[model samples]
Target: MEPDRSTPRTSSRRGFLLTGGALASTLTETSMAQAATRARNTGDADAAPGSPQHPVVTRPADWQPVAERLDGVGRLGTDGLVYRATFPRYDLDLSSYGVSGLVEASYAAFARYPDGRTMLMGDVVATETELQRVTDAVQAHGLEQCAIHKHLLAHRPALWWTHIRGVSTDPVALAVAMRAGLDATATPGPRDPDTAPPAGLDTAAIDAALGAKGVSLDGYRFSFARAETISDDDCVVPPAMGVTTSFTFRSVGHGSAAVSGDFVMTAGEVQQVVKTLRHGGIDVVELHNHALSDNPRLFYLHLWAIGPAVSLARTLRTANAATNLGVVTPDANSSMSTES
Candidate 1:
C-alpha cells in the first residue's frame, strides 16, 4: 500500500509539471501571435516607440496654414512632435527687476495624433484687465482653461499667464479659437526678425557650466526635457509642448545677465529645486500647476536671478541637476518654419 501511495504521488507531480509546461507553451504561442497581429496592424514590425501610435509628425507645408491662422510664425520643435509659435508681449512695456521681456512671452503649440485629432497647448499672457476677457474668449470657443498663474514675483503692468488646452479634429478651427483669445489681449503679432545683438556673456563657459548648448533666440536660451515620459489624458505629451525646463539669459551688462524661466519638476523634486535655487540666491517667483490632468503631477517654479553669467549658469545647472533630465542631441529631422 505504501509503495502504491508513493507511485501515485510521483505520477501526480509529473502530471502537474506536464500541465504547467503545456500551459506556459500555450501562453507563449498566444502572446507571440497577438504581438504579430498587432505589429501587422500597426506596421510597427520592430515595435519601435514613436511609431504609428504616437503623434503624426507634420511637414512644414502642413503646418504653414496653422501658422497663418495664428498670424504668427511657427517652428516645428526639434523633437518633431510639436509645432510651436511664440507671441512676445512686445506691446506691454513690462519690467521686472530691471529687466524687460524677461518673461514677457506667450506661446501656442499644436500636436497631431495618429487618430487625426489635434491638441493645442498654449500660455496666453494677459494684463490684469485682459485676463477675464481672455478667459471668456477661450471658453467661448470651447477651449479648456487649464491654469492661471503668474511667472514673476513683482512686475509692472501686472501680467497673468493663462494655460490653455483644446482638442479638435479641425486644427485650423482650434487655431482660430486660440486667435480669438489672443485678440482679447494686446499681445503683439508675429515675431520680427531677431535683430538683437549677440549675448555679451561668455558663451563657451556658460555652455560648459550648464552642459547644454544655448540658442540665441530672443535671449541666450537653453531648453531641457525630462528623462521620463509625461502624459495627459492618457496621451503622451511632448517636451516642446510647453513642458521643457527653460532658461533664458539676457546680458544686463558688464558680464552679468538677468536670468528668468521656469523649472518643470515633479512633486517630490519641488522642494529640493526651490531650496537649491534659493540657496544660490535665486528668487522663486511662483509655484503652480500648468495642466489639469497631467500624470505624475508637474509643478513649475518660475525663477529670477541676476549675476555673473557663468555663476548664474552654474546655479541653474545645480538646480537642473536636482531633477531627472536627459542629454540634448541635435536631430537631423528637425526643422523650423517661419510661415506667417
Candidate 2:
C-alpha cells in the first residue's frame, strides 16, 4: 500500500508540470494571434474610405488676406504678429504708459479663450467716454476685453492700455471686427522716425557680440536674441508667443553705444535678474506677464542702457545665462499655418 501511494504522488507532480507548460504555450499562442489580428484590422482601416487620406475639409491658401484685414482695422504687422496701429514712443515715460495699459487689456481679453473665441486686446485711452467707446466697439466685434493698465508713471492726457483677442477660422473676419473697435479711439500722434543715437558707438562690434543678424531702425541697431525656452504654464514652453529678448544698440558715437531691450524671465528669476541687470548698468523699466497660462509663467522686463552695442550684447548674454534658457532654431514642421 505504501509503495503504491509514493508512485501516485510522483505521477501527480508530473501531471501538474505538464498542465502548466501546456497552459503557458496556449496563452502565448493566443496573444500572438490577437496581435496579428489587430495589425490586420489597422491596415484595413487605413485602406478604408474617408480617413486622413481623404479629409473632409479643405484649408485656406494664404493668411495674407487675414493680414490685410487686420491692417485695414489699424493693426500693424511687427515681426509677424499684428499689433494695433498706434503712436510709438521711445522715452521710458511715454512707452511705459502705453505698454502698461495695453498689456493689461491684452491679458484680460486672452483669458476668455476657447468658448468665447476672443482672448485679448490692447488700447490707449484717456477719458472715461473714450474708454467706454473702445470697450463698446470691442464687444461689438465679438472680442474679449482682458486688461487696462498703465505702462508709465507720468504722462500727459493720462494714457491707458487695453488687451484683446478673438478665435475664428477667418482671420480677415477677425481683423474687420477688430477694426471697428479701433475706429472708436483717437489716432495716436505720428512717431518721430529720426531719433538719433547718442554717439561714438561701434554698431559692427555690437552685432558681432549678439551673434545673430541685425537690423537697424530709428537710430538703433537691434539684434534679436536666439529664441529660447517658452512656457504656457509652469512646464516647458514653446516658441509661439515670440517672447524674445532683443538687444538694441544706439551709437553713442566713436565706438560707444547705448543698449536696451526686453528680457523674458520666470517669476522666480525676476529679483535675481533685476539685480544682475542693474549691476551691469541696465535700467529696468517694466516687469509684467504677457500671457495667462504660459507653462513656465514668463515675466517680461523692458530694460535699457547707454553703452557700446557690443558691450550691451555681452551684458545681455550674461543675463541669459541666469535662467534655464537655450537658443533654438525652429524646424520646418514646427511652422504651422493659422488657417481654417
Best by TM-score: 1
Scored by Cα lDDT, where does model 1 land? Answer: 0.68
Give the per-residue lDDT of model 1 (tens digit) for 234-268: 35677777777887777888888888888888999
Using Cα atoms with residue i matched to residue i, what is each candidate's TM-score against the true structure? Answer: 0.80, 0.54
Worst 10 residues of 1 by lDDT: 10-19
Off by over 4 Å in 2: 1-61, 72-136, 145-147, 150-161, 186-200, 219-240, 251-258, 328-340
Error of 2 at 340 (Å): 26
- At residue 91, candidate 1 shows an lDDT of 83
Clashes of 1: 0
lDDT of 2 by residue, 111-181 (tens): 11111111123333433346778778767666554445544344444555554544433344455555566
